[model samples]
Target: MQREPLVLESAAGPHTIINSKEVVNFASANYLGFIGHEQLLNSCTSALEKYGVGSCGPRGFYGTIDVHLDCEARIAKFLGTPDSILYSYGLSTMFSAIPCFSKKGDIIVVDEGVHWGIQNGLYLSRSTVVYFKHNDMESLQNTLEKITSENKRIKKVRRYIVAEAVYQNSGQIAPLDEIIKLKEKYRFRVLLDESNSFGVLGSSGRGLTEYCGVPVEKVDLITASMGHALATEGGFCTGSARFIDHQRLSSSGYVFSASLPPYLASAAITAIDVLEKNPDLISKLKENIAKLWTGLSDIQGLSIASTPESPIVYLRLETSTGSVKDDLKLLEDIADHALKEDSVFVVVSKRSTLDKCRLPIGIRLFVSAAHSESDLLKACESLKRAAKIVLVNHI
Candidate 1:
């Protein structure tokens, strides 16, 4: 199928122009409303004028700058990790970070639904990959036991466990603490992708490791797209000093690719500063999530995901036989009606073969601290309209 061009122009927080009409944006990754913050913009602009565009070369060359050190230091301290490394894209961190520890024949037990980055990276590593039921500890343990009992040749191969802190499409959280408890018995390294939880989870604003009371050392690696909650460009991996030091020389993703530029790094540094200064931001963010969750709870035909301590929400649509479909007829029907009539924009899954797509009725909504009570009320109103549109039209 051929596609038509869809233009987007942002006017205000989480709202944008679609084909020239301004509509509320429900599909953005900007969780904390930092994209357009005056201070952040000012910071980035100043750095841009000072540093110019782009890093100009990979960090291995002359591109490494004071701003890079500034941001990484602040992030390391903020997340309670000793060091952090930046990447041009969040997905790059996934490939470079996870493969740093593993080699051929190593066993990796990954959550069935981790974002494709880790899956693809692990595949490239040629490590033996095992899929455990999503967030199911028993299943994961079974797999770990099987790998652990193997011969000495296989025993030399290490095991790593990977999962998201808050699943994006489902708005659910992983059982991080439960998974961590099993690490000791299984001797498996744990990796967390905190794209949705960092800057939002802990009472102190650390990521999932902090939120779960797990020390920073417990996690072998922490990688995420700062583009999400951190509201910065690129991705980062945080861990012990030696781990990052090793990656500096070994991780090709960082060594070959351009380093994060001074301007964006400066902005991220400022964003963390803002988060640290305003602990109330996290408190208010949770309240926003609670309000939305409470509003959506009583709806019929809605199967809510496990409430991870994050602010994303998903509404799974039912099929005639209650299954998945990427055609997303039901999703299109709901979104078209909601946009034209109620002005809501929710995401529908596009990948079909992976079974990630739900019944055409599935939709993803991103809640933000930028939203107000009245804004949430409008969102709920849009959902109610959406419910009627998908159900009544029966598309």
Candidate 2:
């Protein structure tokens, strides 16, 4: 049987109306609660009035506006990088950026747990792709050694190590410090995706490189999205001036797609400005994460799969309820029960088997800075209750 998707007629926040029912929202990516922020709203409104809605053509064909350049420069400054190139859509950033540098003859060693975007990019790159175990430094070392040893005679080939600073599949932070050490040891260029970490990690929200104390120069190419914590609708790649220049001309997404809407560029710029002025927002988010982690500490029939500092909290089955299909159904039922009985909206990770991911399925509960202590407690309590009811037979 097929089910109709619920319609949301309200803005996504800590609380929202779904199917005309008010629910505590745990399915959104508004990590810093900037989705409905007043300053961001005001900035977008002002830009809309001044620049109107959309850019009519591709960035290469008279679509590059001042706001687009401003936003890219602002992001570069915030991250302390030499330059950045913007894309209208978030996923396109990876799909385009990968092929921009890596091509048919080169090699890209990536984590197996990377999201669909990276997978698609790998396909498009036509490169010799190698997969390492998820965040396993030893596995990465072995893969690099094997590849390097096999290709030692191929002087013309290029090599790259690609990974996400914070993995979307498992909600785990990549040990970037170790990855960098391996990159240096193997002489492979590092291409990092900070999509989930940017504007959420680090003291100043400069992403995992900053949080891990890895110098920006160590990374050859870095890509991220402004749609999450930045509360904007575009993506960016920040690195050396040479890298940015190459992407401007060679990256298909940036060269062929219409530039980001000017209002969104304004919103992204304002988001960075706000982050600069109020460092406490990150601190507040940290506090909220700690509170939520502590509250969910004792839930039965479930285990927490994310770190306490991670804004994304994943609740996995303590044991398989049955087969894979049956387990997936149980997880989704828990989410549905949370929504129907307790008015708490949550999500279960559902992916096509074709994706080749090894991560476990779980109920994904996204925590935000906007969530109050009461909201955290409500969600935790509801999740616990729902898990108990749904898994009673399995237990």
Candidate 3:
């Protein structure tokens, strides 16, 4: 049987109206709580009044507006990269970017727990793609050694290591420092997806590279979605001037799709401005994470899967039902009860069977800087109660 999806009547933030009822939202990816920000709203409104609603043509044709270019330049400056390219949609960035650099006969060694976007990119690349155990340096080294041995007997091919800075599927931070070391040893270029890490990690919110103390030059390519922390639509890729220029010409999504709305582009620029002016937001976010972690740590039958520093918190069942589908159903039940009984909303992440992710299914609770102490406490209490009720017999 099919069920209708819940309809949200308001903007997604720490609290939202779902099915005409207010609930503390834990499912939104608005990490820094930029949604409904007054300055951002005003910036977007100004752009809308000036530029109308949409850019009807692709970037190469007639859609290259000043706001689009401004947003790209602002992102490049913020990330300390030479240049950047913007895409109209977030998922399109990964699928288009991977194929732009790596084609057939190239090699891509990726983490097993990467999200569907990165997985789709690998599929489109048509490259020799291999998956290492998620976040395991030893497993990555073993895979690298095997691939190196195999490539020794063949003609030279370009090699890339693709991973997410903060994994969407597992909520785990990739060890960028160690990954960079391994990349140097294996002569592999790094393509990092900072979708979740862009505005949530790092002291200044530059991303995992900054958080890990890795130089920006060490990363070959970096891609991220503005939808999360920036609280805006579209995505961006930053790298050397040559690499970004190549994408502008060759990336299918960038060259063919309509450019991002001028207002959203303007909002992105304003979002970066907000980050620059208020570093305290990032610290407040860290404090919220610590508070939420402490609240949820002692829950029964559920264990925390993410780290202390990660804003994305995952709660996994202590034991599975021996069936992936059934295990996910239990998690779904917990989410439902949490919302119904406690007015707390959360999400259970379940991958499509067609996908090849190796991470275990779990409930994903996104913590934002906007969430008050009461919101975090309520979610934890609700989840603990729901989990106990749902997993009572199994536990």
Q: Which candidate number maximizes lDDT?
A: 3
Clashes of 3: 0
lDDT of 3 by residue, 111-130 (tens): 99988888888998999999
Error of 1 at 196 (Å): 1.0
Q: Rank the candidates by lDDT, best first.
A: 3, 2, 1
Clashes of 2: 0
Error of 1 at 79 (Å): 1.4
Return the clash pairs for model 1, or none: 331-360
Task: Between candidates 1 and 2, name the one with more favorable lDDT.
Answer: 2
Of the candidates numbered 2 and 3, which has the greater lDDT value? Answer: 3
Which candidate should be chosen as best, given TM-score against the real structure?
A: 3
TM-score of 1: 0.93
Cα TM-score per model:
0.93, 0.97, 0.98
Query: Candidate 3: where is the Cα deviation over 4 Å?
Result: 153-155, 393-395
Poorest 10 consecutive residues by lDDT, candidate 3:
1-10
